[model samples]
Target: MWYSISNLLGFGADFGPTTAAGRLLTIGFWMLSLILIATYTAQLTSFLTLKASKSTITGIDDIKNNKVPHSRIGIVIGTSAEEYFLKTISQGSTNYYHLSTTQDIFIKLLDNSIDVAVASGASAIYAINNLYCKLTLVGEPFYATSIAIDLPRVWQYKQSLDVQILQLTESGELERISAKYFNTLTCGSSSSDESSSKKMEVQSLAGLFLTYACVSVIAILLHLWLKLKRHL
Candidate 1:
């Protein structure tokens, strides 16, 4: 404790070990401190360089609360997103940047024209994972709506279609299909070179910790033996 504190604070620590086990533990402690500091520095550097800035808008609520200017909020003119913004966010006022396509939403986001892009979850995730590596999803969906297929008013196969869809869902086939499409990572994934850089793990220092524990036990035993001899 004293040595680590002194070293970290740039003060000289004169820790003189009176026993061999204590000396061994001192070496282990030194290595442990080194790894801790190295790991901390690596994590800090990664965060400062790779992470997004604080001005990043987190979700629909952030935009609604004016964390970003409403004008900077981009929505495709014909999308459900624009309808949501107009009805729920803008409250019938067209206080948003009307983008004509999904591509424009991302382009404007990158070029600093828009701070928030209102879009469907699946489309946004697909774009981010497949096309825009730099743009990542930050928040939960604005609202969840049920998906349905429009059937004729007097369709005879309606009951059969519903049964088959329910069977697929119950069998987990629907979820598996959804995952196959939406969950495949292609951008800014941890497998990338920058993110894959090695950092300290508990297992990396496990042997050192075990050695220190043994040295601590030996030191305690030696001290007890010495005290007993003096009492005798």
Candidate 2:
């Protein structure tokens, strides 16, 4: 049944479902399968591309200021860096192009389609030293994040995975991977002055919210107190 849907939807060209109902049921499965496949494929490609170009990216801010050329920067769609760069950094750079696979980005870089690439700095470091690409950090770091291994929730494997990941992190394997590609001195530094400004903005916003909430509570309490005194 699912095989028929795969055939009708042009999903699994290699396999076919025997029943019509099975094919219909497969429509949903096929759609989900396609989505997952594309996502995984993009990740795999991105990893390969990052591996190839980690040495060449230079740093995060170069891509923002058009220092790397508008056509040269590579970024994955829907990634946090992509969102931050497009919304906050690459304001006037019309030459920028969005890429899905990191592998494609690196290929483009190698082919001279792009001059710089941005991804997780940690992954960039891993690719740089191990991949042996000729590249260097162009400027300061961009954003920072910690990586964790996600395990299946079935049978309560979270604790085991956490321990294993902690061991890997504590043993310095993670740092070792980072030290290979990135300049150990500034691997995770924020690339732009604006980042500091953003931090200020966030703090200010938090303060404003807290103040407003407190004022609202005080006003409500005062109104209730006045109403009770009148009743008395």
Point out where model 2 deviates above 4 Å.
1-59, 91-95, 167-232
- Give the best candidate by lDDT: 1
> What are the per-model numbers of colliding residue pairs?
0, 16
Candidate 1 lDDT over residue span 124-180, tens digit each: 778887788767676777687556688899999999998999999999999999899
In order, candidate lDDTs are: 0.75, 0.57
Q: Which residue runs of candidate 1 sit more than 4 Å off their true CA positions?
A: 1-47, 50-55, 151-159, 188-232
lDDT of 1: 0.75
Query: Per-residue error at 194 for model 2, in Å?
Result: 33
Question: TM-score of model 2 relative to the true fold?
Answer: 0.43
**Candidate with best TM-score:** 1
